[model samples]
Target: MSKYIQAIGIWFLIIPLAIINGGLRENILIKLGDIALLLSGIILSICIFVVAYLLIPKIKNCKQTDYFIFGIIWFILTNLFDLFMYISEGGGIKDLLGSYNFLTGNLWILVVITTFISPIVVSKIKKRKGEIKNV
Candidate 1:
């Protein structure tokens, strides 16, 4: 698929996640207390999405395995960065990490899946188009 289509897919994943998370934040966390982290979470999630999506695809042969490995690496890397931030800043926004859901964390994982699937799907389309052109 084209980048436009990929972006649409990303938006599809982001929107529902935004709704669910917004609800959870208002109903559970905000009602309880600790909304100081709200702005940071929004910023972080978007930043992570933008940075990872741009950075990951450019790397050569970034397969499903590559995406998965990169995801795990980024997960660890974020935690490590958080560790440093926590140490330096007397606990920054990253310290409140568990406040969000992970099962479908803003559909970031979906990007990883797309990384795996997009090449296969796009390549097949390309091949079919080439055949049609030849015929």
Candidate 2:
């Protein structure tokens, strides 16, 4: 299969995992409040990045550009999914967007930034490991 197709497949696979993460985050917030939510975000970010790093190499024939494009698509899809969930749960668009506010709501910025960067970081890490092995 082509890299683009593989990327799309990976994006689809990630959606459910993202939803699960969101659910876990919500539960944690309900139980422990914002501090736990923030900590969970950091932990979840690390776990997701590690998973991406491990999984990216399995996509045969994917180039660095493909990884980056996948990251962008994943980022966009995740935010849209979040918005959908928020609205489905009876939230207004304002509430959906307000969670992105760094000052008050949870640290969604971390997740946003991590989503944008994870694929690129994974690609570079894999490339570096290949170089080290070749040397």
Task: Identify the candidate with maximal lDDT.
Answer: 2
Best by TM-score: 2
lDDT, candidate 2, 36-61, per-residue tens: 66766676677667767767677776
TM-score of each: 0.42, 0.80
- Cα-based RMSD of the predictions, in order? 10.4, 3.2
Taking the tens digit of each residue's C-alpha lDDT, what string does model 1 give over 10-104?
Answer: 43444454456556666665664554244435544664465444433434433444444444444444455446656686876555353234342
| Backbone-clash count (model 2) | 0
Q: Each prediction's Cα lDDT score?
A: 0.45, 0.71
Clashing pairs in 2: none
Range of the 10 consecutive residues with the lowest summed lDDT in candidate 1: 126-135
